[model samples]
Target: MRRLLGRDHDNRGFGSLQRGTEDAAKGQGDASETKGQSPIRHHGGKEINREQIHQQIGSLSELTITFLLDKPRILTDIQTEYRNVYSLSYLSDREFWTCSFNDNILNLCNLQGEILRSVQTKSKNWPYGIAVTQSGDLVYTDPRDCSINLVSGTQIQTLITLWGWTPLHPCGTSSGDLLVVMESVDNKNTKIVRYSGSTEKQSIQWDEQGKPLYTSLGNTKYLSENRNLDICVTDYAAHAVVVVSAAGKLRFRYTGPPSTLLESFSPLDITSDSLGNILVSDPYNDHIHIIDQDGHFFRYIYNCGLQCPWGLCVDSRDNLFVAENVSGKVKKIQYYK
Candidate 1:
């Protein structure tokens, strides 16, 4: 597959943003020069450097601006039994798996939202994440036990037990491996680890210079691997969408849109489409932001009337599924024309 953002594209605007941020982080930028300019927008009132805004605008030229006019419609809204549905994954085009944070139950439901089969978790620990493995088995994480469990045809087994780390989210990659989001015992360190069965294959934590790649505050990091194997994460605490190369190298970070409608950009769940574009849920702004693989701001899905969109997933045909947390409903939407 072609690289999501072609290497030949002029990304100098983004490069300038990266350099300016690095300089600011190292205490090298002049404070007086930034005194009056409308500080470029960013999460948490931090000075969004000019380079960052320039880069975001520069990326718009490469995007299909007309796609925004293709408004997405809610094909259907299926109500569930749970009070709050935290996570969702597709078992097939006709079926899906969902975990209830309040009821502590894992459900296998049809497109009509009818419960086909239900299983209580092995422990009182609520399942925070869920995914379907290559073998069609269901895998989930129990934060209380720090264990990753697999369920095949009603038989539940412990696949891996994390000793010092806490697994928060689990996603199945196209290569049949599993990518898990984890946190340290103190919750001050967070990372993503790739596992082949029970053996750890790779760990992504720090950058080349050894600085932590993600914020180390909470276990709200949701992850999905793109078609090109770039690991995409929605960091709730950092208020940014962080993407890294398959080798765990930091590629780019996208802080939400630079619109006045947004006060804070807190991204929750994330998924990648067939075209390699990244879709992120921004409940704080009551809309979702779609960006290119290179982290360029594209457009917003606001006409769909989404409320507190907590979970996101894309089917094989590129159909988008959104979990509305407050109303206990799931909306199937179509964005591409």
Candidate 2:
């Protein structure tokens, strides 16, 4: 049962973000060096007007740069009825859907932890993964039936069912598609597949060298597509966060920061912020890792009273929601300014 994906930390201290500086251009130098004129910036060889200065960050054209707060604090904590909260997905800025590993019930709760609505899986089996679509509908994976189901109002519809594979994690992409991490019944093969409704669009299984990208040990891989369209997966058995380009090319793998206190890096749930920064929950260490899109270590969120942090998701405002398995509480953390 240890490898069957059902699994079961503390604390608060401030962790600072080690901000890195980036040059405007590779060798062209800063435009501000010419003291007599207003500060102008160049992006992709195009001149940026003074009015757009605040809107741009580094090479990102339209993205507004946001910095981490000196002290990331929990805004509020929402208590749930689940004995162990497993997964959660943001339905709106004020609402989210969550489910426990042992229960078939999925609850839609507001920021105050009020259960405004609840739905049970049609199969009456616990959902291995849950995601909310752009249309504000619930999509979940039922490993017990090897099916991907969607909840549209009061109707529960089966989207897809597999014969030999069991879907574990489902993430709704920006392009209105779905990405799922699945494992063979024998647990000898693991892969991620993208689906356009019920039709399979892409499969990400092997690396450039043809080696398996994810561990076949268990169905514990949780994934999120970043703002830059990169698919980020936290492979618990691998003890690494594997990120790949939108085209399925390997980008990088982050295996925790150097000199960590935990015996092993156990990354469960993953999410990406507005800045394309990948946030992963390290429940074994009682912290969350904040890394840049390029896999650079940014900092750690350790002082936010996290214990057995499992599922993670960022709201539209970039505020983080962490599901603490042991406490049965979901903490809303404001990390960025």
Candidate 3:
């Protein structure tokens, strides 16, 4: 296995880089996985080569974290180290899931980022963007399938079939519902809608003036709500994080100060930590920004070698899991005091 991040690694241009996401169906490991470990696993006596992971180390800068960063869990046992999980989503209190680029769903050991066990997928396309409900059910969007599906109790079922359409992305809520941000009509009509298993529920696309919220940009994605009864989302076209009250009232906005780093970032996913610190994905810039509750730039975590981090989620322990679009790999960054 290769190291995901190392000081000696320099991201040479495209010709020298390896696409980190391997074929999930064939799988790249002989590690016996349990729930909460890595998404890739051992199959019958065969092993998949995951050695290409560390060689393409992308160049990223260090962020000034306000709070201390959590210690990364190191897997000593070679058979359970989940080094290539592409998505991090919790299905229950003691169980979470990770998937590889080729849709190998596995029960994972999250705190240390390990793989527990895996159930292969029927559909072989690469899977990303996972949304697990409160009741140990999983829902996710597959770019290849052009739809969202549910995975629970070893059964995979299609819930929503979307083609030629989808907003920024979909996220799971506390009530087992999905809050989806989608791009529509030439990217001019961006909206967030709640889905009760694919059925449309409450919506939050209108502003105070009742204008439909939309952006004509290719980089529109990600939505989240704060504990303080406010909704915060990223608007890549506007180059700002849009904030509104739960009742649709405009609260405030946060944008990084002007700089080359601040330019052309397609903000994807967002989450609010227990400290009321808001972290949003700036995938285009290969970093996640931690903003204060007052919407001020605090710091950037995992700043380099990130190629369009999408599918962002934070667990109960506040570990940030980011999905890298190009690499098709999900990396976990533990946050602590």
Candidate 4:
């Protein structure tokens, strides 16, 4: 398989050069896939041509087909007017929800950075995490009150309240379930819990070795459910991205890519694209890491003038909205063609 990034590879004006080949290969692979046939043949040790090689590569998985732009540019910079945008969730392509640190107000803003509406937490406390549901409702976690709250239209309701754990990040899954990352009040235990409404359906905390899957310290862990139903979390204390299967079994952990920056790998926010690619924000390194579902490091997205890129969420069309903590600007970046 061709490597997504190479040491000597130049990043300028390369998208158009590869698009034609990849698109053609994808079409061939899709046709062969529907018929349940292999694109490669073993006929007396025959050598495959370039076209056959492309088809064989494409047959691997559609999720691996990424139409990434050679030079990803920022579509617009939305001056959110917050002290610092700590969390971002897309309610729609034109509207999103943003909240600042230790702030009790959640502002719904358009692409032009106009505050269309605002909602306060049920307890008038800051929300640790925010997410948009499939039904276009807003869900957030209030650690001060140890509850998960839902905002529908003009009403705010407490959906789930914990006894000994404090919810840090709440992610709304496509199946209408919620994935919340919570830590024990004592700060000694951390786990990801799946909730169907207010009821606990599953918990993912221990690995196959009966050890904690995430570090016990740190409130920067954020999560997202991939297109393949895999749960991805960025463990700030652990300095790694931990992924698990839908059954809550540990799959793999990505520490960081090779030739990292001087600062340690400190991942804060996490999200997944429509192609099942995982995107992680590394504020310390001033870039975003794009990895495959199986934990392969593909490339880095840092050229769009990102400064302290903290909160990340992709829109319905896969356009990335990056909330820069220092600049207080929500940059709409088109990473893919």
Each model's TM-score?
A: 0.80, 0.83, 0.62, 0.81
lDDT of 2 by residue, 167-249 (tens): 88888777777888988776688888887767776899999999998998656689998877899999987989999988999
Q: lDDT of all the models against the reference?
A: 0.71, 0.73, 0.52, 0.74
Residue by residue across 155-235, what tens digits does model 1's lDDT show?
Answer: 777777776677778887766778889877665678899876666779999999999999875566789987667999988
How big is the positional error of residue 34 in model 2, measured in Å on the Cα after superposition?
A: 62
Q: Which candidate comes out best when scored by TM-score?
A: 2
lDDT by residue (1-337, candidate 3, tens digit) is: 1211122211121111124222211232201111221111100111222233224432111122434453433112112244333345654334456554333454555444455556555465445456556565666655444456667677777766554444335566545557666544233455676666556666777767887554544433556656554667777657778887756666777777445455465465677764456788765455677776567665676533455555566656665666655554555556555
Better of 2 and 3 by lDDT: 2
Q: How accurate is candidate 4 locally (lDDT)?
A: 0.74
- All-Cα superposition RMSD per candidate: 15.8, 14.2, 14.0, 15.5
Q: Write the per-residue lDDT of candidate 4 for residues 119-146, one digit (tens) a residue.
A: 9998897777888766677888777667
Error of 4 at 55 (Å): 7.5
